[model samples]
Target: MIVLPWPPSVNTYWRTFRGRMLISAHGRDYRVRAVAAAVSAQRYGQAKVAVRIEAWVPDNRRRDVDNLLKAPLDALAHAGVYEDDSQIVELSIRRAGLDRANPRLEITVEGA
Candidate 1:
């Protein structure tokens, strides 16, 4: 699976912010783990956030997982989680037997 550098605060934000998306996509039903890493700070009473995301998809539905990433990303962009031009730092996909012991789609995003 893609293991990203997720800070505690960012994890909380994602759990709340993407909770609906996760539920809508039946995330809990899938035997997969999705993670996000981000930098957040408050300055002058304004919050600034930057993020990176890692999504672990199952071997059976790599294509479906690819499609699934689009919506939440768009939603995050719309919500200003990161800049529109945020770049993807890395993407790696590895194949393994069907189980949580191994991951299929390992994606990492940076500058977002």
Candidate 2:
């Protein structure tokens, strides 16, 4: 498993650029951090894989878990964990309760 920082919400991940959308600063930073944290990860190449993400939120407030998938998946793709996010044949995310001092995601990728 690879431990990574919690990603920004999908709502904050993109910004309006004229009439187009672009990755916001927060999104870009998360991508960079994802790559850094995944340095020791084993690449999966083009193989189909299953990814399980365990999230520890800083608060007990409600949040949409699905909205957190894109950034980390994209970051993993960019980091060469697989050719693309499409290679993820299965994905799951769990709300692992609070961790105010160290809110994060623990990700596990396995061959499917």
Candidate 3:
């Protein structure tokens, strides 16, 4: 299991400046990847995986759950928690309600 601060959506992670896609979201990818790496379970050579995400958000904010999933999945891969995100056989992403003070993501992984 790993927990991380909420990340920018994939939609918000890039920008088109001068008509070319560029990384406009600063440090999030690196931060997510680094945090995952530090806490990695090191589950290597896994054939299939199950992922559960409990996304925490503010009271008035509505986040697209699908958009929020990509970053954490990529982070887990980069952290070597699993061989690849393609190995995920079962996936669950849910909104666990509002946390006005601290908005974050809770991720849990298991072999399937």
Best by TM-score: 2
Tell me the spans in candidate 1 whose CA falls farther than 4 Å from its real position: 1-54, 59-65, 83-108
- In order, how many clashes per candidate? 1, 0, 0
Off by over 4 Å in 2: none
Better of 1 and 2 by lDDT: 2
Model 3 regions more than 4 Å off: 15-42
Error of model 3, residue 41, in angstroms = 2.7
Tens digit per residue, CA lDDT, model 2, 19-39: 999999999999999999998
**Residue range 1-88, candidate 3, lDDT tens digits:** 5777777678777778899987565535655554654374747566788889898886666557888876677767767788789999
The candidate, 2 or 3, that scores higher on TM-score is 2
lDDT of 1 by residue, 1-112 (tens): 1332211122222334544523333332121222232123111112233333444444454443334444344333433344442333343333324545443333333332
Model 1 weakest 10-residue run by lDDT? 37-46
What is the C-alpha RMSD, rounded to one decimal, of candidate 2? 0.8
2 or 3, greater by lDDT = 2
